[model samples]
Target: MEEKTYKIMSGSGIMNVIMGISAIALGAIAGVMLIYSGVKLLSNRQGITF
Candidate 1:
């Protein structure tokens, strides 16, 4: 019983760590994309007219 509990807890901890890393990677990618888009818009601002 204790062994099973320890296995389950270890699995859960590993999954949580994996998910945390993935979330951070996803957030970093999104942030980079946003910055790139902003830079593109600024660079092309002269071509846009109201």
Candidate 2:
């Protein structure tokens, strides 16, 4: 009984860790893309005439 409980707990712990890592990685990628898009917009604005 105790062995089964330990296995289940370990599996859950590993899943939690994996989820945390993916979340952080995805968030970082999203931030970089946002910054890149903003820079692109500003760079293109200089070429526009009023």
- Off-target runs (Cα >4 Å) in candidate 1 are none
In order of appearance, the predictions have TM-scores of 0.95, 0.88
lDDT of 1: 1.00
- The candidate 2 region of ten consecutive residues with least summed lDDT is 41-50
- Candidate 2 regions off by >4 Å? 47-50
TM-score of 2: 0.88
Per-residue CA lDDT of model 2 for 1-50, tens digit only, reads 99999999999999999999999999999999999999998989978788
Please give me the total number of clashing residue pairs in predicted model 2: 0
